[model samples]
Target: AKLVAATHNPGKVPEIAALLDGRFEIVTAGQLGLPEPEETESTFVGNALLKARHAADLSGLPALADDSGLSVKALDGAPGIYSARWAGPGKDFAMAMDKVAERIEATGTEDYAAWFTSALAVAWPNGPAVVVEGRVDGSLVFPGRGTRGFGYDPVFIPAGESLTFGEMEPTAKDAMSHRARAFAKLKAALFD
Candidate 1:
């Protein structure tokens, strides 16, 4: 079976594909030349569903979308849905990380508590959809870390780990990532 990953982000495709565990051949909305739908929804699930439905409707194939973000507890969950936007138009995560550090400094507190959230949605062409959410708690690390993962990976240290997601090996990080958790639920709900 062919499944459409309703994301233009090249980084997310491989991660999503790996989570799918070869059950389906994966193609991306970007590869299909499908335009990214505006994420007008206020919540992750809503945005994921919107993107999934858009791709499914346009491609006439089942589509999957994930709306994931980094939420800083000190910032009151700011940049949750706007995680990508924080990276600016060019998606410069380095700059985004710096901005996060600056914001935290302005907060005048050492509370670096944070979490990553992932909302996964799947939709069939002109049909119903399913959505699930997952989260992983952690804290922020200034100056960032390794260059392994994408988005806010460099600055996030999952609760029990020292290395940031960017420092951990792909398989290692995949084991406990927010997206992985969501994918686990998605598999149980739809694949298993």
Candidate 2:
């Protein structure tokens, strides 16, 4: 079956495609000329559902969308839904990293505890939508390292791992990523 991934980011396309490989013929919304939907929701599930439903309606196909972000316990889950915008319009993650690091430093608490949370939503043209979530708990580090992943991956270290997401190879990161966990659940619901 053909499925629509409700996003235009080329980076995400490959990651998700790899996860859903062979199960469906995945296509991006850009290929169909579908405009990106406005994310007006307050939560990951809401935003994911909004995007997926919009894409499914426009393309008349099953659509998948994900909303993932870094939530710092000390910051009361700040930059949760706003992680993308935290980097601003140009998506300058460097500045965002600095800002986050500075904020943590200001607290005078070296507690770098944080978690990456991902919520995946799938919407069918005429069926009730489904949502699944996954998370990877870890700590944040200053002076970000590596260049493999993007958007705060360099500063966030997963639990029981020495390297940040950006430091690890794509295959290594994907094997245990929060998005991978969420997608696994979605895959099981659909194919298992």
Highest TM-score model number? 1
Candidate 2 lDDT over 58-86, as tens digits, reads: 99999999888999887889889999989
TM-score of 2: 0.96
- TM-score for all predictions? 0.98, 0.96
Lowest summed lDDT over 10 consecutive residues: which window, candidate 1? 8-17
List of clashing residue pairs for candidate 1: none
Which stretch of 10 consecutive residues in model 2 shows the poorest summed lDDT? 7-16
Number of colliding residue pairs in each model: 0, 0
12-119 per-residue lDDT for model 1 (tens digits): 988998889899999899889999889999999999999999999999999999999999988889889999999989989889888889998999999999999999
Candidate with maximal lDDT: 1
